[model samples]
Target: MENKTKKNAVVLLSGGLDSATCLAIAKSQGFDCYCLSLDYHQRHIAELHAAKNVANVMGAAAHKTANLDLSLFGGSALTDDAIAVPESETAGIPITYVPARNTIMLSLALAWAEVLKSQDIFIGVNALDYSGYPDCRGEYVKAFQAMANLATKSAVEGHAITIHAPLIDMTKAQIVTLGTELGVDYAMTVSCYQADSHGEACGLCDSCRLRREGFAAAGLADPTRYKKHV
Candidate 1:
């Protein structure tokens, strides 16, 4: 950590509850947060809008959105128009899992952290209640951190970049509770895999279901706007 009065960190803000909550946690820890969101051409741009709102409301020092075309590969429901966003949760890894999404996002974050000469990156990846995404696991985050340490000039110079996954072990309910305590506005986040242009959630997507359930478990009123979902 630098001897500056406040440490600087790059927070990956997805405009979802977890990421927003993660940003709040980082802020609470006294870090000057630089928020990053990715526009990988997902099914809707609503989440990007939510990310922007969260970053602004949280009073981030800066926010940057990087544009990428993950749909060029198009295997996942999010990136491919042909693949429908699954309304029901299926077993195993779901169709919504965009291949190498976190990997690419972290790589980009790592690049920016190096440019900023910061040694901290915060992501909101969780293993429990994570809707079967393999990359959200604890081991995956550790592996990425190890790779980042070996791959960056900062590491060689002894300023090791710490990839922080603050919500990795928390369940959705716990996440919601923590975020609420940190003053994260749930209504501003769009966690739905298929949110409408206005940022209204589909309610039936795995992400939405989990988010809804989280609020329920936390005994909080869900402020998410939803379309007429079956």
Candidate 2:
């Protein structure tokens, strides 16, 4: 059932709810998806495993994990053991923001996209119902898209890379509903910022709170696996 004429797309698959939905959307759009996940030594590294499973089940043409130690330059709680992931919401951009994470991930995806002759790159960064990560904004995505076009050799040769952020303006409930309609398995994705080794979520984190609320608001039973104590 593969469409030989379908264009290729590089998807930044973080193995989270949003990214998984993004992949399904890309597939639905008739693109041959190439999923890219990062192994950045995050506290919730279990999400990488979730990413692999999600990519496989979603029928990605290929999946790659680019290994890098982002913890070395860690200024955020996710990458540094010294900092604690705040269970409650904090003001003015929480400490969980990884410095230049989306930018770095996009650069890697762009490299593979250029090599694969793909003109599309998909990221599931949402502005609504999200932790206040500045990189998740629509304006940031637009700026990055402009920069990508100017920086890539492929773009200079008339092939422009389009950065897709399908969930940028959507509420979490809307996203969950759309993904469910697209046949995405929400349970297979992990959104916890500090998941355990078995991929069980700590329901107290900001990510978990949003996810839990999303399913509730959508009137769908949340299938996320949380720790027994949570």
Candidate 3:
């Protein structure tokens, strides 16, 4: 079978485990990756640094950071200092949901894909592990793909864009397993909403809870520095 997917792909990397895994997956699938990270003025800057390192280690074609001040529109915990990031996973949507974040990021990624004429864009969003973010849902991604195709001139002309979310259905443990198989060093990835200046993972945030649980469930030691894991 002639491979329809080109060697080039744009990956949305957040310097987190899921995104790093996505990058590894894309590369393993024979796609030369162009990693895109965003500096949207989130509380944690460590993930951005981690993204760069992961991209380098994973051998992405290029890793670029886009500066968009989502902090200017601060309402969510990630962007606002006044809002405390929840440490536990409560029922329903959490307060950490950044409004339209994936939407904005994916739109930018679509533009890049259209310019490069790339058929695939990989994101690491997962519904199971996700924290009640409306945009992270599988259905939303599909809708976004359809909308993107119709909105873009390239898709209108004939070349359709595919938004690929391989980690959408997988649990965190499964993701950890896949990343381990792919030779991804989990130590290189950071998943803390609030980290110290040196990027030490905060052991109390919801993100930390998820990461710790994933490692525990996978029966693997988390390489990240943490206070505790359960």
lDDT of each: 0.93, 0.95, 0.89
- Model 3's C-alpha root-mean-square deviation from the true structure amounts to 1.9
For all predictions, the C-alpha RMSD in Å is: 1.9, 1.7, 1.9
TM-score of 2: 0.97
* Model 1 residue 144 lDDT score: 95
**Which candidate should be chosen as best, given lDDT against the real structure?**
2
Which residues of candidate 3, in runs, are more than 4 Å off? 1-6, 227-230
Q: Which residue ranges in model 1 land beyond 4 Å of their true spot?
A: 1-4
- Kindly list the per-residue Cα lDDT of model 1 for residues 1-230, writing each as its tens digit: 23347888999999999999999899888899999999999999999999988899889999999999999999999999999988987999999999999999999999999999999999999999788898999999999999999999999999998999999999899999998888888889999999899999889999989999999998999999999644
Decoy 1 TM-score against native: 0.97
Candidate 3 at 218: error in angstroms?
1.1
Q: Write the per-residue lDDT of candidate 3 for residues 26-133, one digit (tens) a residue.
A: 888888799999999999788899999999988989989999999899989999999998877778878788888999889888888887788789999999976778
Q: Report lDDT (Cα) of residue 143, candidate 3.
A: 100
> Which scores higher on TM-score, 1 or 3?
1
What tens-digit string does per-residue lDDT give for candidate 2 at 1-230?
Answer: 34558999999999999999999999998999999999998986799999999999999999999998999999999999999999988999999999999999999999999999999999999999999999999999999999999999999999999999999999999999999999999999999998899899999999999999999999999999998555
Model 3 residue 168 lDDT score = 96
What TM-score fits each model?
0.97, 0.97, 0.95
Model 1, residue 84: distance off in Å is 0.8
